[model samples]
Target chain A: EPEVTQTPSHQVTQMGQEVILRCVPISNHLYFYWYRQILGQKVEFLVSFYNNEISEKSEIFDDQFSVERPDGSNFTLKIRSTKLEDSAMYFCASSDDRGWETQYFGPGTRLLVL
Target chain B: SQQGEEDPQALSIQEGENATMNCSYKTSINNLQWYRQNSGRGLVHLILIRSNEREKHSGRLRVTLDTSKKSSSLLITASRAADTASYFCATDARNFNKFYFGSGTKLNVKP
Candidate 1:
């Protein structure tokens, strides 16, 4: 089965530095999403991308966060300036259909902003 | 405000037991999905129950969705030590694809 894959399984960066998390979604999938899980907290939605644009985003997805499908398969999330509270496990998911179909998720990238 | 919240933050059971977790949401949803995550790991898709479907099963996992009540339940039967993980319920709300996940239930199946 084809699965979503992410780059840099773990990332460590300074609080003021920028970070980019990359993901290669399932080839045929049209919808992509990014979620983050803080330690001992629920998974929180960050943003969703489809057709080369963000479809929906959460309040947590502030101006510091941006997502782009730079290429056919590569979807990246860029944080302009990281914060200590941004430390979390970031997961990328994709699905061929929306709102009703199953979404396959990547193993996730653990981001630590110190 | 979170859209979904899970009950019983933690559970412990002997091997070969059953684990049940409940999820309650605030908004109408198109579907409810169950996912599992091991310690410090990513979410893994387990089962999905559509709004129109009351119940669905895959292998040892069973999920039921009650639209009227805006709640769902996931049952893992004959669970083993491998089933020891955090289980979460994610909702695909009406008219959108983003997932709202609950806090999850941590199950420790003692072998």
Candidate 2:
């Protein structure tokens, strides 16, 4: 089965530096989402993208966060400034246009902000 | 924010036995989804039950959603050693397609 794939399975960055996480969603999917989980914590919604624009975003998706569908197949999340608290596993998921279809997740990018 | 809350944060069972996990939400939901994670890696989609549906089953896995009570349950029948993983319930936030996941239940099935 086709699945979402992310690049740079793990990243280590210093505080206040910029970091960009990349994802290649399923080719035919219409909606994409970004979520993050702190170690041993619940998964928190960050943002959702559709039609090459942000459709919905959570409060946790603050000024430092931005998402882009620069091309047809790539969805990227950029953090302008990393903080220690930003250390977590970032996941990318995608679903078809059919409302009933279930979302599939990628292996995830482990971001370690030092 | 996370709306679904699952109970029995951890469970251990012998292979061939059944494992059941429960979830409750604070608000109305369009659908409830279940996911499994092993060793803190990627999440694997298990099942999804719409608010209008009371029960659904896929192979040995069963899911039930009670919208009136705002609760749901996932049952893994005749479990195996590979069934050991953390199970989580997710619900979409109102008016948005953003999915919020609850604290997962860690299941350990010993062979």
Candidate 3:
């Protein structure tokens, strides 16, 4: 079965540095999303993208965070400046338009900021 | 008490037994979904039940949703050791594209 895939399975960055997490969603999917889970915490929604634009975002998705669909299959999340609290597992997910409610998640990129 | 909050943070059962996990939400939802994650792995989609539907089943998994009570349950019958994982319930609220996920229930099936 086709699945969402993410690059840089693990990343280590210095505080105040920038990081870009990349994902390649399923080819035919129309909607994409990003979520994060702090160690031992619940998964928190970051943002959702559709039609190459942000559809919705949570409060945690502040100015420091940005998402782009630069190409047909690539969805990228960029953090301008990382904070220690930003250390967590970032997940990329996608869903086709027909079953938009059911999301397929990638293996996730573990971001560690020191 | 929050949206998509599951009960019994952890559970353990012997192989061939059944496992039932419960989840509750605070808001009206468009649909409820269940996901499984093994240690340090990705979230795996298990099943989804719509707001209008009461029950759904896939193989050994059964999901039931009660919109009136704002609760849902997942039942795994005759589970195996591989069934051990963290199970979470997520809610897709009406008019929202994001999902609100529960804290998750950790299941340990002893073989």
Candidate 4:
């Protein structure tokens, strides 16, 4: 079974620095999403990307956050300036074109900002 | 805000025991999905139940959705030590493209 893949399984960055989390979603998937889990908290949605544009975003996806599909398979989330609160497990997910399709997720990148 | 909240944040059982987790949401939903996450790992899709359906099963996993009550339950029968993971319930509301995940229930199936 094809699965989503992410790079840099774990990252440690200084506060105020920029960070880019990369993901390669399932090849044939059209909808891509980013979510974060803060330690013991629930997984929170960050943004959804489709057709090279953002389809939806949450309040946590503020000015500091941006997503790009720089290539056919690569979907990346960039944080302009990281904050301590931004430290979390960032996950990338993708689904086929079918509406409400099951989303396949990557192993996730653990971002640690200090 | 619309959110999926799971009950009994933690559970522990021996191998071959059944585990049940429940989730409740505040509003109408288009579909409900269950996911499992190992410690510090990514989420794995378990099952999805549409609003029009009442119950669905896959292997040892059984899910039931009651849209009228805005609640759902997931039952894992004859669970094994490998089944020890945090289970989450996610809701997809109508016209909403994003999914809201619950806090999750941490299950510890001892061997």
Candidate 5:
């Protein structure tokens, strides 16, 4: 079974520094999404990407956040400047059909902004 | 505001017992999905129940959706220690591609 995979399983960065979390979603899947989970909080949607553009985003996805599909397989989330509150587990997911369909998720990247 | 919320934030049971988790949502949804996450890991898709469906099952996992009541339940029968993990319910609102997740229920199935 093909699965979504992410790089840099864990990262530690200083506040005010830029960070890029990378993911390679299921090859044939069309829709991609990014979500974050604070240590003890629910998963929060960040953004969804399709056709090289953002389809939907949450209020939490502010100007500091940007997503790019720089290549056919690589989808990345870039945080212009990290904040302490940004420490969380970031997961990348993809679905073969509509974004609402069942999505396969990657193991996640743990980002710690100190 | 959160779309889904789960009850019994934590549960502990012995192997071979059954575990049940309930989920409630605040809005009309197109579908509800259940996922599992190990400590510090990612979300794993478990099952999805559409608004029109009342119940669905896969292996030891059973899910029931009551659209009218805006509630759902997940049952894991004949559980094992490996079943210990946090379970979450995600709701997809009508015409929306995004999913709102619940706080999740942490299940610990002891050997």
Candidate 6:
């Protein structure tokens, strides 16, 4: 079965540095989303993208975060300046346009900022 | 904030025994889904039940939704040692695009 795939399974970055997490969603998926889970915490929604634009975002998705679908298959999340609290597992998910569709999640990228 | 809350954060059972987990939500939802995660790995989708549906089953997994009570339960029948993992319930509320995941229930099946 086709699955969502993410690059850079793990990343280590210095505080105040920038990092980009990339994902290649299923080829036919139309809606994409980003979510993060801090250690021992529940998953938190970050943002959703559709039609190459941000459809919605949560309060946690502040000024430092941005998402881009620079190409037909790539969805990228960029953090301008990493913080110690930013260390977590970031997951990418995608689904087709059908309402109430099930989203397929990628393995996730573990970001460690020091 | 709308959040999915799961009860009995952890459970353990012997092989061939059954495992059940419960989930509750505070807001209206379009659908509810169950996911499984092994240690230090990505979540694996298990099953999804729509708001209008009361029950759904896939293989040994059974999911029941009680919208009136705003609760759902996932039952894994005749679980195996390999069934040991964390199970989470996620809700796709009125905003179908965003999903809120619960803290999850950790299940340890002893062989």
Model 6, A70-104: lDDT tens digits are 98889999999999999999999998988458988
Candidate 1 deviant stretches above 4 angstroms: A98-100
Which numbered prediction scores highest in DockQ against the true structure? Answer: 5
Q: Each candidate's root-mean-square deviation in Å?
A: 1.2, 1.2, 1.1, 0.9, 0.9, 0.8
Can you list each candidate's DockQ?
0.77, 0.72, 0.76, 0.77, 0.82, 0.79
Interface RMSD of each: 1.4, 1.7, 1.5, 1.3, 1.2, 1.0
lDDT of each: 0.90, 0.91, 0.94, 0.93, 0.94, 0.93
lDDT of 6 at B30: 91
What are the per-candidate TM-scores when only chain A is compared? 0.97, 0.97, 0.97, 0.98, 0.98, 0.98
Q: What is the lDDT of candidate 1?
A: 0.90
Better of 1 and 2 by DockQ: 1
Candidate 5 A-chain TM-score: 0.98
Model 6 interface CAPRI class: medium
Model 3 steric clash pairs = none
TM-score for candidate 5, please give it: 0.98
| Tens digit of per-residue lDDT, candidate 1, span B17-84 | 99999999998888888999999988899988889999999999888888899999999999999999
Off by over 4 Å in 3: none
Backbone clash pairs for candidate 5 read none
* DockQ for candidate 1: 0.77
What's the CA error at residue A88 for candidate 2, in Å? Answer: 0.2
Q: Which stretches of candidate 4 lie over 4 Å from their true place?
A: none
How high is each candidate's TM-score?
0.96, 0.96, 0.98, 0.98, 0.98, 0.98
Cα-based lDDT at residue A84, candidate 4: 99
Q: Candidate 6: give the TM-score of chain A.
A: 0.98
Q: Write the per-residue lDDT of candidate 6 for residues B14-96, one digit (tens) a residue.
A: 99999999999999999999999888788899998999999999999999999999999999999999999999999987787
